[model samples]
Structure formats: C-alpha cells, structure tokens
Target: MDSPTILLTNDDGIDSPGIRALANGLSDVGEVTVVAPADNKSAVGRATSSEARVHEHELGYALEGTPVDCVIAGIEALGPSPDVVVAGVNQGANLGMYVLGRSGTVSAAVEAAYFGVPAIATSLYLPGDRWKTVPKPEEYDEAVRATRYLIERGLDNGLFELADYLNVNAPAPENGRTEMRITRPSSVYDMTANHDGETVTLQDNIWQLMERDSYSEGERTDRQAIVEGVISVSPLAAPHSTEHHDALDDLAAEY
Candidate 1:
C-alpha cells in the first residue's frame, strides 16, 4: 500500500494530549482519521451507543460515546474503512490479564479484531504521584516514537497475521531511545471490598505492591516489564476458547 489509512480513537477523549501526540507522531507514516470520545470515557470497555452523535473537529471527528463507538462509527458511518485501527497512548497503563475487560483502551483494539482489522493499543505506565499529575506533550515522546515505529516497521512484517492485536505499554524513556520487551499479562489479582455502614468500597491492593516494589521480578510479564521501566508488548488473540474435558464427554454420553 502507498499510504496506509489509520483509524485513531481513544477513551481519553479527542482533546487529550496523548491522542494529539499520537496523531502528530504518526502523521508522516499514514493518513490518520480520528474518531474519538467527546469527553473522557476511560475504563468503559467496549461500550456502544445507539444514540451516538458525531461532530467534525480539526483533528477529525468526535463521538459522543465510548472508544468502541468511535471504532464502529469510523468503520461504518464515517467514510472508508481503515487499513488499521490504533487506540490509545492512553493516560494510564493497562496491565495484567484481569484488566482486559475493564480497559477501554484495550477494548477498542479488541473490537477492531472482531471486524478482522489489525490494531494496536498503547499506554504509558506511571507510578504513584505521576498518575495525578498531568503529563506534558514532551513526556509522551517515548510512547509516540515507539507507536510510530511499530506501525511503520513492525506491522508490515506480519505482526498482525499471528496476533489479532497488540497491547503496548511503555514507561518513560531514559536518555533518548527506550527498550521494548515481549511479555504476557501478569496474573496478579488483588481486589477487595471494605464495608462501613451501608457503603462498600472496592480496592485493588496491587497498587500497594507496586508502590512497595513487591511485584515479583523477571521480565516475562507486562507488569514486571513496566515496573522495570521497559516497554511491554503483549500479543493478544480475540477468540474466547474452551478446553475439552473427559468429564464433560462422560456426562454428555450419560445424557
């Protein structure tokens, strides 16, 4: 293909600095058309709306819905279908297997996979106070660079043929260039509920582990890689699989 058409969307809203940096970084790589949420819709995984409203923007277009809505609108209601769907450069990292259904960033890529279009979902891993502070555009340099590199060089090399989509998480770059490592989502789960009177608060204790450097080491997992300041790239498939068991077969035979 001469110039690939890239469909860009995010849960952080169209005006977010992350998406803006992403669009600017990939501008030279292909024709990018933006169809993103009108306001921050973070963590609303794969949600769709029948009453979505679309409006033109200088960046491209804004959807009064979730990132998933943006993807469907871009593919069906907008103009031409895109060659690839790119999501995020998300405000926060989407790590661990448990987070897949809870992350709008990754969900956008998953939605694209159902349509048979290759996609990449990107995010930055910020620890502690960093999450509360808004990052400047320059802080996104590493993520933008890695994202462009993947689209321009990695995609054509059959990266998409094997995996339905990729979840890329990066830490802030150290000198100039950053290091990337292939990894799987860490199987860490730390959810709890605290009850006081009539109210209950849900919490994920993993944050405390992260703050304490208590996450198990070894760079084989996305959570580990992010903790070590490396970019984590996890190749993911879309299908929900089932395992064959002899007990099920025996039960079926009896029935």
Candidate 2:
C-alpha cells in the first residue's frame, strides 16, 4: 500500500538527536513529517494545550507544548492526518507499568491511540552510569533500527488490530545484535517516599536493583528483556478495564 505518512514527535524537544534519528530511519519506510515539542517536556504524560503556538522548522514543525500537544497539532493543524504516530527514540527508557502514566513518550502514543491511529513509542535503555551522561546522536542507532524494524514488519500484519500501540525499548547498540522479545510492562513497583524535617524525597528503588543486576521479572517482561541486552516490544492498549465482579453488580442493583 504505497508508503504511509508518518507523524514523528518526541518529549525531548524538536532538536533532539533521538527524533532526528527516528525521522531519518523511518524515511525509508514512509513519508515522515515531524511535529514535536519546542522544548523538553519529558515525563509530562499526555498533557495538552487547548491552543498551542506552532513554528515552521527545517524538520517540519515545533509546538510550544508537550508531546501530546505536538500530536494534536500535527493531526489537527500542522500536517496531514498521519497514517501512524511515532513518538520518541526517547533519551531514556520508559519501561514498567508504574512509569507509563508519567512518560511523555508513551503518552504521545496513547493520545494517538485514542484518535484511532496506530502508534509506537521507542526508547533507549542505558546502563546506570552511562545514563548520567547523554549518549551521542550515533548512540541512538539501536533504537532507530528497532523502530524501523517494527514499522516495516508490524504495520501490515494486523499488529495494530490487536493492540493500540507498541512500547519499544533497546539497549545500547554496543550490546551487539540481539533478538527482539514481545513483552509486557513489568509489574514490579519500587517507589518510596521519605519525609524529612522540611523536605520529602521520592525514589524509584527499581533503578538500584537494575544497577546491581538484581531486579527480577518474568521472561516476557520489558524490564527483564532490556536488562538482558535484548530489544523489548510491548503491545499496549489505551483503555482501562476491570473483570466482572458480582459484588459490584449487586451494589449497582441496590443503587
């Protein structure tokens, strides 16, 4: 079906190397139009502006808002209705269930899902110390490669028919070639908050475990897959659901 039109964006801002790498790689698979945040809006999950200022840029357009705002603007104002929305090639990993709701990269894809458009979110998983220093643009090769692989392989196979979006993560390219694993967001939760005399400190202890190679999860979990130097591909849905509960049904009858 002729090359699809792709709407590319990121929470790291329009000028980030990650987005550039994505745009470049996806160009081989589709017509890529980038509309991303004007400045870093990382972790601003699904936030949007009712009205946003947009500026023309060499890459396409930049919105003065969050990643979700970029998608809204791209689909509604700045560019053609996209065949798919691709977010990130994010600087850091956005793995695990607890982190999804707070990740601008994942949220961009979620917004697209609600619009009835298939989407993909990509991120790079750096080892603990490597994360302290931002990697060079070339370092995003692994993420860009994995994204292209999915775009070419998944789009025509009814992959989106089964899932709203895909959450993809890759370890550094230096890890060498590794197999991609179809996985789920890890259920591990390690958040803790401490109150001091005049301050409160919140920490995600999962990072500590990840650093020590001690974090554990099922074989088909995103966190475990990435830690093992493999690409993680998680099929995700935007909606929330609950199993049938007789108690709730009875309560509804009373009401």
Candidate 3:
C-alpha cells in the first residue's frame, strides 16, 4: 500500500510524550494523525460518548472523550479513513488477559477491529521503582521502534489476516535490548483490596509482584516477556469468543 495513513491515539492524552514519540517515529513510514484525549483518560476501556467535544492539535485533534471515541472520530469524520489504527506508547503496559477490557489503550484497538481496521496497541513496561517518575520520550524509543516496524510491515505481511490487532509491550529502552517475542496475555492476576472503617482501598499489585520475581509464566506470556526485557507482540481478535454448551441448552429446555 502507498504511504498508509495511520490513525494514532492513546489513553495518556494527545500531548503525552509517548504519543509524540510515536508520531515522530512513524512519520516517515506513514502519515500519522493523532486523535487522542485532551487529558489523561487512562484505563477507561471502550467507553463511548454520544457527544464528544473535539479541537485541533498540531498533530491532529484532541477529543474530550475516551480512547475509543478518538478511533471512531478519526475513522468517521476527522481525517482520511486510516489503513491502520495505533494506540499508545501508553505510560504503562496493558498486559494480562484480565486487564484487556479495562485498558483504554487496548480497547481503542479493539474498537478499530470491529470496523475491520487493523490496529496495534503499544506500551512500555515501567518497573515498580519508576512508577513515581515521569518517563522521557526517548525512554519510549524501543517501543516506538517496534511499533514503527510493525506498521511498516504488518499490513503487507499477512499479519492482519490472522487477527484484528496486535498488543505490544516493550521494556523501557534504558534497560538495553532484548529479542522480540510473540506471546499471549498472561493468566495471572494480582489485585488486593483493604477495607478500613469507612473506606476501601484497592490496589493492583502486578507490578510489585513482578519486581519481586514472584510470578513467571516464562516466554509465552506478555508480562513474563517484559520481565525478561523482551518486546512482546500478541495478535488477538476483537469479538469475544463463544462456544456451544450442552449444559446451557439443557437448562434452557427446562426453563
């Protein structure tokens, strides 16, 4: 395809360094239009708004809505119909299977899949110690490089035929380089909640768990790949899977 148009978005807002890095990195390969949130909209999943406000940005547009809204707007009204949708260079990784529905980054890509547009969701893995600090745009280099490679070759390489989009997680570039690996969302989940007298505190301990090497599914899983400083690319479909069940059929018959 001739200079494929790329619709770029993210949960971290249009002005985020991660998205800027991605836009700059992918510019030569394709025309990148960034239609992202005006402010941080992280972890909003596939939420949509009947009316979302939009304004112009240097790269493209910034919408006062969720990531999914950006994808929809980009494809429908904002710019040329994109050849592919790219989300993130997210501040944090969207890894395990459980977090998929809660991640605006991945959800944007999923929304694109429903429209039959191939997408790629990319993120950087921040270790537990670095959660308090802001990452530089250059820190996203490895992730952006990986995303650029996929955008350049994915459409022509039969990758989209296999799945709707790809979920990629790259180790922070400062950690040095590692081989890219094809992987799956990890099955592990780590969430804890504490109830106080009048308050409930919820925490996602997956990053902490990772720091201690408390869990490992090895190379086959996204989290494990990031832990080992490897770039992970997992091809996945958008629609939820379904299967016939005799038990459900029998229950329906009795009802």
**Scored by CA lDDT, what does every candidate get?**
0.86, 0.88, 0.90
Off by over 4 Å in 3: none
Instruction: Estimate, for each residue in 1-255, the C-alpha lDDT of model 2 and write its tens digit.
Output: 358889999999998889999998888799999999999999899777888888999999988999998888889888889989999889888999988999999999999999999999999987766765668988998788888877787788899999999999997667736689999999999899999999999988886687565766778999888878889999999997888999999999999
Misplaced by over 4 Å in model 2 are: none
Q: Which should have the higher TM-score, number 1 or number 3?
A: 3
User: What clash count goes with each model?
Assistant: 0, 0, 0
In candidate 1, how many Å is residue 104 off?
A: 0.5
User: Rank order by TM-score, top first?
Assistant: 3, 2, 1
Model 1 Cα lDDT, one tens digit per residue, 42-67: 98987788888889998999999999
Q: Write the per-residue lDDT of candidate 3 for residues 89-179, one digit (tens) a residue.
A: 8998888999899999999999999999999999988887674567987798889989988888889989999989999999867664668
Q: What's the lDDT of the predicted structure labeled candidate 3?
A: 0.90
Best by TM-score: 3
Off by over 4 Å in 1: 173-177, 252-255
